[model samples]
Target: MAFSSGDSGGSMADINVTPLIDVLLVLLIIFIVTAPAMTMRVPIDLPQKSVNPPPPSNDPPPPIRLRVDANGQVFVNNNPVATRQVEANLLNLLPPAMQDGQAVEPADQPTLELDIDRDASYETLTTVLAAAKNIGMEKVAFLDNM
Candidate 1:
């Protein structure tokens, strides 16, 4: 009987996982090496908050409009003016109420609206922006046709 037990005929086989473990380790190493290279770094500066509140206003604000046509012509409050004269006109046209040396009053800054044609060049738009900056008009906005 003991000799007959050795006559069993079924063969046993097992799958080896060494190759799969090696492939997984290689992939993990590749990802770890390339991850930092694929990422980008950017620097930004954030603003701080101010605790003091703005002063109160007693009078209605004035409106200043500057328009740029497709031909690069400039207009101040609907009056056609040259590009060279924009700075001077903006400085001169500042409301008298905003003049310096008055009492501690709320800013009488005029609301500046820029109307630019769709075909206007960037040079023209930037020139107007520089002029507005030179004249100390801080509250400038763009006018869009609805």
Candidate 2:
């Protein structure tokens, strides 16, 4: 039993907020701990922007086929052409970006696949290679068959 001595006896009017404050603070800490887990983030660095261009495509552009036959005949894509015309013809096949007598990145240029006939004269191969090299064609490779 409780009694008041005031003129008008009344119950307590001020609320005790200590427990409320404690509950609120605990809930806030729980949310802070669980918020990162909710996002399901894996520890990694995602680029904010495109730092480097996308990796080069797996598929490469078609290669130019330069075939030399045993008869010393020079062929550009299976079409016979004169030895003197080989350099001009190969340069014609080049993309516009490679003709400036400047260095071009290997990835930006087309490839030259030399398919020299097994019995083809070595002199013909040398002549064709020289012509290609003269015009700054550096992505040349040899074909094993034909």
Candidate 3:
């Protein structure tokens, strides 16, 4: 608090801004100290463009499209498959190593595109998803069949 220097020796009504300035300066110092740390980047190993990279030898395999209709009928590549045989049918489409219970390499993993009817039962959807998961088919995608 500051006292008035006028004839009236009462306390000044004006705000005491010295403390506010001090606090602002302290905050400014804290931000200055932390600014560099905040912007410290994580070093990433980005792939560099090669001057003469070799052309890819072969095209990737076409994605397997699986369709599930409103009646819960499952189809693999447009061929109707029984609900009990869905897993086997999918396994047949995969590479032999996958069918033989071997860990699949990422490059050899086949993508499964699921085209599901909106009116399809949740039970049917879950069954399809469970089969894919159990078979270690990681690249399953939902197709907008509308």
lDDT top scorer: 3
Runs in model 1 deviating more than 4 A are 1-56, 97-106
Compared with the true structure, what per-residue lDDT tens digits does model 2 show for residues 96-134? 767667776656667889988899898888889889878
TM-score of each: 0.56, 0.57, 0.58
lDDT string for model 3 (1-146, tens) is 77779898688789989999999999999999999999998553344677976554365556889999999999999999998788989989888788898996545678899999999999998888888877878667788875
TM-score of 1: 0.56
All models, RMSD in angstroms: 11.4, 22.2, 10.5
lDDT of each: 0.75, 0.80, 0.84
Better of 2 and 3 by TM-score: 3
Query: Which ranges of candidate 2 are over 4 A from the true structure?
Result: 1-60
Report the lDDT tens digits of candidate 1 across residue range 1-146: 11233557644455667889999999999999999988966432333565985664677477788899989999998999989888888877777644442332335577788988999888988888888766666667788955
In model 2, the worst 10-residue window by lDDT is 41-50
lDDT of 1 at 54: 61
Stretches off by above 4 angstroms in model 3 are: 1-59
